[model samples]
Target: MFGWRRRNRTGRKTGRSKKQQFKLDKESVLPNHFRCPISLDLMKDPVTLSSGITYDRESIEKWLEDGNFTCPVTNQVLRSFDRIPNHILRKMIQEWCQENQNSGVERIPTPKVPVTGTEVYEILSSIEASMKRLDQCGFLESLKKINKWGFESERNRKCIVDNGTATTLANAFVTFSSDDHHQSLESHNYNVLEEILSSLNWMFPLENDARKILGSKPSLNKLVLLMKRRDFLSTKNAILVVEELCYDQEFIEALVGIEEVQEVLVRFIKEPICHAITKASLMVIFSMVSSSNHDHERIKTQFAEMGLVTLVLNMLIDGEKHLNEIALGVFDRILDSKEGREAACGNDLTMPVLVKKILRVSELATEYSVSSIWKLSRIEKQSNEGRVLFEALQVGAFQKLVLLLQCGCGDSTKEKATQLLKLLNPYRAGLECIESSDFKNLKRSF
Candidate 1:
């Protein structure tokens, strides 16, 4: 490998740095054929596109991910994006690496074959055939295999979604759910049902059509029950499916009308928290509450009556930074009614938490929290309802609002904070600490 003494411009080996010596020792001059055109490095897992140009799989995948439709070398429109492995070239490269073992060359391991659309179709066909025969165990096993494949690669995920896997699983789940006596299912059949629900949860980009199938009342009840299970991953998946199903007003109202559904979601949002499930539940509620414009007050009234306000308040107090932001966003939307405002102020921790987050968590959280407080102040000013203004004073909300402006919060948050400060000006004397030097200094600054 070091047959010839290669030297720099000075033609002296004594002046070579340790880094250069190391590079020369490990990475000897590679044959041009061994290098990828894109990265100009030793090829690993080389694959060919329809343009017939071979490139490293990682480089080509990154190119495609960047939205390029043409081959790198050919600059030609790709006839197909399917990547075919160059096994002959790969074997040659592996042999060359083995021959150059002293140069620190490592052998490339065999690459996983990219999933094809045809493979996805065959799996779906087998699943359909097995399900028709009432082969519960076989069907469950097939679904599990597909689920495992779906998580392996983005290509497999797309193939599964495009080949009607999600739709089929959703239909099966809906059919099983429509049976009113599912409680009497045999143990194996019950396990199959769980797998079906779990498989449906695995489906990504759950399109509107599949969502429509699962949004049915019966289907929703099944999902809620699945979400209530003790298993974290299974429950998280069920919550994801439920969020996808709440696509519009009718579906949202149907879900909201299910008291147990609301209770379960609220319970998840509040205790023994799984962050993913909590985020999904919050998103589902946001979609449901935001979908209804004409019946928003009534919907918000129902959620408030179900103790959603207190649940969300507790979440805001205990959730992590990102969760706090989403919880605040959902809480802001719910504050469209008197009950929502009263529920917030009734919780002794709400104002304190809102004020505490003014410049904390994130910029998005700051905006949402300020919006929630602003909504409360407006409601209080309009209806002479709760002591929201006094509560703000009690929680140092006024000082926080003033500090918010100086701390470089977003324009919207600063605007809302300004408006809220002005709205609560009438209650300034209610602050017992107003005469203290710190309070006096902040009040003057405001």
Candidate 2:
């Protein structure tokens, strides 16, 4: 490689590197067939489809990934997913690059062969056998190999998944979850669990059968075991899986009935794991008792009895902006039920804390905070009207509501702020001076 000093002409050394100085000549155009039709660039790894159109392997793979099954150039429905490598063409390209070594074009490295479905099945068999006999070394080795293969390419990972390995791995994890497995947990098996989780993460948005296996009683027990272990990687991966399962309504109902699951999820928030785990824990809970769920009222009563109200109050006192938004969203749902309202009202910090969050965080957070105060105060007035309004006003809910409406917010949020403002207005006598600015428009709604 020639250094800049050697290529310099006008005394000072040129800043260009050898590759830049040797860039492919624009005048010496590349052969048209050598370029990928999609990227319009020289092909690195050429492969042909059943439609007889050739494309760079990476480009075609990406096109397929985006859910387009048609050949890009031919516009024909691809009869197969098979991408036969054009070895002859690749060799020709390599020879041409070598013949023009003076140019910046470098020969592309040989693309690694992706793991086939057959090889994936073979590895799955090894993992199953290793798990059956509790062979720590064998299991760890297989898990690491699975991770390596998955890391090679998204194609390889998809092949491993197509082989129905996700369910097998989940069942294996369930078997390893019992105290029987805990006897050997502190050794290599512990780290092996992380590897298993890594492999599972690669196959996420798991197939229906795999989700059924993971959402089962055995797997729920396994998640509880992992969370209780308090090992960072294990807990993080376990919660992520739990979060994924939360999307299924059936699983949400089943998970809500599991006190152990509820306890661990709440403890993660209370004790504070990493932000991701904490946020995921909250999301799981939110999914469990969201109003969209049929059993939301019953679930709300259950979580309120478990002190979810107190936990969120503590979180909002010091949590970051996004966490505050989620917590308040959960808080909004909690107050929908009579039990949640009572639980929130029992705490002295409840109204004041809701007021504190109103305009202090992100716009979404303010919406949640304002909606929560509106919910609680509206409900609490049935029993304790004096104290609810007193606390909200004392904490400056009135002033925050004025500014929130003036700054402009979502239509729903704007309506919520207006309603909350009306509720807190009568408590402040002679408030005529504050009506001319942002509140001028809101005064009509009030």
lDDT of each: 0.75, 0.77
lDDT of 1 by residue, 327-362 (tens): 888888888877887787677667777777777888
- Candidate 2 lDDT: 0.77
Poorly placed runs, candidate 1 (over 4 Å): 1-28, 48-53, 58-71, 74-84, 99-105, 183-188, 200-202, 231-233, 293-295, 382-387, 403-415, 429-446
Weakest 10 consecutive residues of candidate 1 by summed lDDT: 437-446
Off by over 4 Å in 2: 1-33, 49-53, 62-81, 88-107, 125-141, 175-194, 291-311, 336-367, 394-418, 430-446
Candidate 2 lDDT, 293-337, residue by residue in tens = 677788888778888898898777668877888898888888888
| Candidate of highest TM-score | 1
Cα distance off (Å), candidate 2, residue 115: 2.4
Q: List the residue pairs that clash in candidate 2.
A: none
